[model samples]
Target: MQLNQRINAFVELGKLLKDLAENETIAQTILAKAEAENGWFTRENILFSLNNWAEALTQANLLQWMSKYNVELLPQESNEVKKVAIIMAGNIPLVGFHDFLSVLMTGNKVITKLSSNDKTLLPFIAAQLIEIEPRFKDYVAFTEGKLEHFDMVIATGSNNTARYFEYYFGKYPNIIRKNRNSVAILNGTETEAELKLLADDIFVYFGLGCRNVSKLYVPEGYNFEAFFKAMYHWKEIIHNHKYINNYDYNKAVYLMDSFPLLDNEFMLLKEDKGFSSPISVVFFEKYDSEESLKKEVSKHSENIQCIVSKIGIDNEIRFGETQFPKLWDYADGVDTVAFLLDS
Candidate 1:
């Protein structure tokens, strides 16, 4: 298929997702299946993902995003298609959709190994795309076995599994992503509205995505009162059994270890230098100045995915908008489209 045809198919798929997000009956049924398969795929989180993608897949957004690249120069016919094998991560719903979209938009075929925890959603999406354009039926695939006959590979996993991916797919052109977390740089002057939005950044998807803010850099003597109060916006999230279980367990362990912790009944805040915090916990560190903090952030830039702040730092994502990444916001700052086009 041509690039325009591929783009049109995805735009139509986006509209279908928008309609599904609105149709509560269909959405609930899909959510039921998702939840049954993975307890972390809560209805709220899945819908949040769907709504974001729906907004992202507009024709204008696609064309504007594509305009940055010369995708038309890539091969269009099926015979010339480059096969891209994608190993998806299941931490959040549809985490691999962007890579999937990039491969197809570059006129490549995809051989996906679906994460067991996310088995239901992307396949359903692929089925919809195939329905919209019959040609996509040839471009999309899912395999529970060994991947073979692919020109390139894109994989996402933990630092441990990434090593395995490298050992195996190292010879092939690939994009293998490892564990990375988001951090927020906070000044004492943030407005209540912004703090409330930051709650969504931390709590949406239950802090499961790479985009979720798991760490914080706050000015010295930063009072926790306003931050804690703002976090109450997601108090209902505590009702999730799996979340409460984590909170209880982590709180108990920290108490036993005599670690200093700030607790607000649901989430735990610990003064930590670490980037990746456990579920129901957010790590925090005190910074003396933006210059020092920026240096520190740069030192560990490889471990961070998004930096949420309005502190005049470079490439910082605004508060609460970390999850709403645009089509061009490539994960790991690696351009998947460019990789595919060059492949």
Candidate 2:
């Protein structure tokens, strides 16, 4: 398919997603599909993912995102069409959709190995895309078993599984992403509105996404009351059985170890130097200076997915915006489209 044709197909897919988000009858169909496929794919989360994609796939946004790359040059660079295998992560809804889009946009065939935890949504979206542009039917396929018959691979998993991916897919051109988490830098002068927005960064997707704020960098003597108060808006999340179980378990472990914790009866905060925090918990550390904080963040750069702050650090996402990444905001600071076109 031609570049504009592919872009139009996705733009249509985006419109369909918007329709599904607004039209209750259509939304329920997708919700039922997601819920039956994975218990954690609640209706709210599925719709959130759909709505975000709908916003992202507009004609204008697609055009703007594609503007950075020379589309004509992409085909000239690699006229040999290859099949790219995508091993998706199931941490949040539609977590691997970007990779799926990247492969197709680069004029390559895609063989997806969908995560069992997120099986339904992508296939449903794929069906709609095929309906809009039948030619795409030849380009997309999903497999449940071991991946085979692909020229290259893009995989997302924990650090341990990434080692296995490296060992297995080493011969192929690949992008193997390990565990990474986002962090927020707080100067402690944030308004109530901004702090409330920061809560979205922390709690959205039930904190399952790599973009979710798993850690906080705050100046020493920063008050906890404001942060906890803002977070209280999401207090109902504790009623979620799975989340509550995590909260109860992690809290117990912290208490048993006699670790100092700031508890809001829903989430737990502990001082730590780790980037990846457990679900229902956030790690925090005191920073002495902006320069030092930047240094610390730079030290763990590879392990960080995003930095959320109003501070003008390079590539830092604004509060509540980490999860709503623009198309150019490639994961792990690695350009998937560049990889595909050049490979």
Give the C-alpha lDDT of model 1: 0.92
Top lDDT hit: 1
Task: Tell me the tens digit of each residue's lDDT in model 1 across 94-116.
Answer: 99999999888888889999999
Write out the backbone clash pairs for model 2: none
| Lowest lDDT block of 10, candidate 1 | 71-80
Question: For candidate 2, what's the RMSD?
Answer: 1.5
> Evaluated with TM-score, which candidate comes out highest?
1
lDDT of 2 by residue, 112-209 (tens): 99988888888988999999999989889999888999999999999999999999999999999999999999998898888989999999988999
Model 2: lDDT of residue 323? 79
Clashing pairs in 1: none
Q: Which segments of model 1 are wrong by more than 4 Å?
A: 77-79
